[model samples]
Target: MDRHSYMSFYNIFDKNLLEKERTRSFVLLNIGDALKNHEIEVYYQPQVDARTGKLCGAEGLARWNSPKAGLMMPGKFIPVLEAANLTYKLDICIIRQIARDFRKCIEEGTPIVPVSFNFSRTDFETCNPYEELQKAVKEYNLEPKMFRVEITESTLMSDPAKIKEQMTLFRKAGYEVLMDDFGSAYSSLATLRDFDFDEIKIDMGFMRNFSDKSKKIIRPMIMLAQSLDVHTLTEGVETAEQLSFLQQAGCERIQGYYFSKPIPYSEFVQKLKTMDCCDDLKDCEK
Candidate 1:
């Protein structure tokens, strides 16, 4: 990831945005080539069935390997991409990449598990993401079951009417739509009422403040999902105690540092081959 190899990529940007310049555009100038050259990648974090402790699905998180800055996390560059009105571009890149990766896993005879991807609310407004995504999935000659779409609870709060339409469209297309960051915002109940989510990702912020009180809050969330016939997956599960409690509380799936951090798809495929998910998993950090 050396910029010197593609120094001309910087020439397209205003000199002020170049590496070592004053602004954050250092990240911006890298996006086009990043997507074209495959520097921006989708990393997979394993989710396991709580009861059986086995690999069930994964979340495909975007990671940018900037030639200028080594590797960049989503939080660092996503907002910049958003402010520049280019967020939709990056989101689509990840979706298309996931389709290819999922297709590869299938052709190689790997156990096919669904991989969920997040879509920013801006995506709904900026483009016909639903149509574009459907095309990508179709192009790969894959079924809808291998692809899952995750939407943040807050994204719905921004535009419930539009969000509702999206929820219905995706579900009708035979794709499972997940409510991501369930408890992070105040509109959880409202979002739940208006839309049908296949799964609920109870926000990890609740786990950050892990306590007796938070456990009480989490318990009901799982029960509520069960009542609605929706599966539950809790994020930020980083310890034996948390895993044990989530399993006992009847959560269907769990993802966090307890099992592994997000790793490249190649490593994820390797882990899938050997991962037992049998309570003896040590922390994975690659």
Candidate 2:
């Protein structure tokens, strides 16, 4: 290759790399501002008691209403936030939003159910999550029992001692801790024996298969949780057959599209009202 041609190629490659880094930097700068400006929203997906089919609670999932990118799911921004060392900031924002919504529900006479929020491993490593959560609950006049914390199996595997310390703090503060996406990591069985989690959330992948082979694996897992006297929940259940199988397998709780998708606070409030009315009607009929 000619010297001039090589120089031109190098210049083009460097320019492309610089442009990519600039774009990433821009997105990282905007995440914090987005939280401050109310562009980040918390959507709630309802969980139901499998045996009674009654609404039990909801999980708080974060969504970004980016001015530039439109509505973005967590999958798009969470990793970026974690990489930028801003996961705890986003976690605090979600907790504040949940507190505000929970207070509103109480004022409106809607039944207040516990809502679980996810915490990244970065959160535990970077800050005191238990103290932050305690402050938020106290500021919003919320009982600690009104909130739950979900940590994935991979998160537990990241640093078991630190994670367990945080989990112990959460328990002491009256918050129930859930081991989320169980069976998705190598230490699932070991973590169960080690941590005192209030519930275990089976990963959605099991529901995706739901074959005879999957059943052999899933049934025993649920039974294991039951045997330990811990509650079991399965996510991503989207069909009657899957729901039936989970219920029969002794799963105590479920959260997935089979019940309803993660919805905005307004719609979730309406759902709460509707469920309350239905329950009242059934009581009257009885």
Candidate 3:
């Protein structure tokens, strides 16, 4: 067979195989019902100021627990939902849940620091996506600044003009914008130029290293953001040494196990209680 005929045969076989793999149909199995049924839970990871031990913010990571699937992370099914044209519904579900959780935190007398959520490029292209955000905030009586939305460099650089416009609207609405996983892509600086980000999150790879080369890679990004008056957040900071490096480099915040790992809502509340009690003990010692 010729090259063209062989390529056509391969394409047909590949399509058939992929369609068969999707036959289990996880996406079509009433994901909305699962969310409504309270099968989904949002996990909170705290972000702390490096200079002070105070909690500056938190990031919301989604998890799902179904009677059928037991437990799963967003990476397992979010892409499937997106491929099935159900991402908008999934996004709405997540936002509404986050709003409800924010209200709960407020009621408990914990200061409601901003919590960040990831948003895909497809979400921005949806008609009146900002309106959906507005309604959620209004309904929950949540301040727009009480939440941050994180976007990755890959999405922002794909269409600079459009992402810039959408992001400006987010800023005007009092939502903090964070460029997540910075330095992971070549388009990082381009995206930074195209939009006004309130914060930039350092990619974890450099966080795993404290070598001279790694310091060289990280310090420039922090300096660049500081010059623009944007806060820099470092992720995957699991050791005191890493936290010290980030502080020396002038990173605005450090997140990860040098502080504490992401915990269940109940556990997080308990953690706050323990910290408060420790403060009282320190005061008594003083």
| Model 1 Cα RMSD, 1 decimal | 10.2
How many Å off is the CA of 118 in candidate 1?
Answer: 0.4
* Total clashes in model 1, counting residue pairs 3 or more apart in sequence or in different chains: 0
Error of 3 at 229 (Å): 0.5
Q: Across residues 144-211, which tens digit of lDDT does each residue of candidate 3 receive?
A: 87778888887687577787787889899888889999999987887788678999999988867657
State in Å the error of residue 201, model 2.
Answer: 0.3
Q: Which of candidates 1 and 3 reaches a greater lDDT?
A: 1
Question: Mind giving the per-residue lDDT tens digits that candidate 2 earns over 130-174?
Answer: 988998989978888788899998788779898898899999988
Q: Which scores greater on TM-score, model 1 or model 3?
A: 1
The models' CA-based lDDT, in order, is 0.83, 0.86, 0.77
* List of clashing residue pairs for candidate 2: none
- Once fitted onto the true fold, the runs of candidate 3 whose alpha carbons sit more than 4 angstroms away are 1-24, 276-286
TM-score of each: 0.87, 0.89, 0.84
Clashes of each: 0, 0, 0
**For residues 1-286, could you state the per-residue lDDT of candidate 1 as single tens digits?**
8867764433365654554343356667778888889888999999988888788888999998876678889987887877777888999999899888877766675555778988887887788768878999889877776778999877777787887887788899988999999988877887788889999999998778889998999999999999999999999999999988898899999999899999998999898778664332221110
Once fitted onto the true fold, the runs of candidate 1 whose alpha carbons sit more than 4 angstroms away are 1-23, 276-286
Cα RMSD for candidates in order: 10.2, 4.9, 5.4
